[model samples]
Target: MKILFVCLGNICRSPVLEAVLRAHAEKAGLDWEIASCGTGDWHLGHGADPRSRASAQRRGYSLAAHRARQLCAADFRRYDWLLAADRSNLAEIVRRRPADATARVALALAHAGLPQPLDVPDPYYGNAEGFEAVVDLAEAIARAIVARDAE
Candidate 1:
């Protein structure tokens, strides 16, 4: 499976999700392709946020090689899944979706079976605790994705 995680700026949530999910996918011995990008280009070519990197590092996931990029039209056809961090970004992704695009787009949290108001809350403006929370959600979503693939 090929997957892409999307966020507003690509420095926090999406990259975290990409790393966590990549680790989980590897552990499950799945030959999956995974990547991440932002709906906005503000952080393009920048590394993952320090806080996000530190959080994932503590959990044994590396964000060292992550570089932010903006979502492009080609992404719609390249990934099997295009997961958004929140509703706003998801809306942007949907609006940019091409008619022939094949990716299954959805909120990362809801796709993980989380309840209403599904969103992988942005940790940009928050503190360490917020980044930690993103890690928690990333792990859960990663596990869920692995399980679903197993099925």
Candidate 2:
């Protein structure tokens, strides 16, 4: 299976999710493909935000190889699932999604079985603790996805 994570910009949240999920899936012996992108063109081709990288690395998940990319038409059909970091990104993705697209889309937190307030908060403008929260959340989500896939 293939999965794609989406956020406002590719440099922060989505990259963290991508790396965490990949590590979890690998550890669980799942062969799923994972990637991330943004709804906006900003930061395209740039490396993941430094704070996100550092935060994830502290948790033993590496964002070292992540590069920012914008959501493209092809992504819809390329991934088996397209997960949004929050409601707004989810809305934008659904709005921009092609009618013929084949991917299933949902909020990442919700898909991971988290309760209401299903959005994964953006940590780009926040303090170090915020990035840390994102990493924490990423680990939880990675385990959840791995669990679901295992079943």
Query: Highest TM-score: which candidate?
Result: 2
Tens digit per residue, CA lDDT, model 1, 1-151: 8999999999999999999999999999898999999999888899999999999999999999999999998999999999999999999999999999999999998887775548888889988999999999999999988998767
lDDT against the true structure, per candidate, is: 0.93, 0.92
Question: What's the number of clashes in each of the models?
Answer: 0, 0
The whole-model C-alpha lDDT of candidate 1 against the native structure comes to: 0.93
**lDDT winner:** 1
Pairs of colliding residues, candidate 1: none
TM-score of each: 0.97, 0.97
| lDDT digits (tens) for residues 13-132 of candidate 2 | 999999999999999889999999999998988999999999988989888788899999999999999999999999999999998899999999888887555888999889999999
Those runs of model 1 whose alpha carbons end farther than 4 Å from true positions after fitting are: none
Worst 10 residues of 1 by lDDT: 109-118
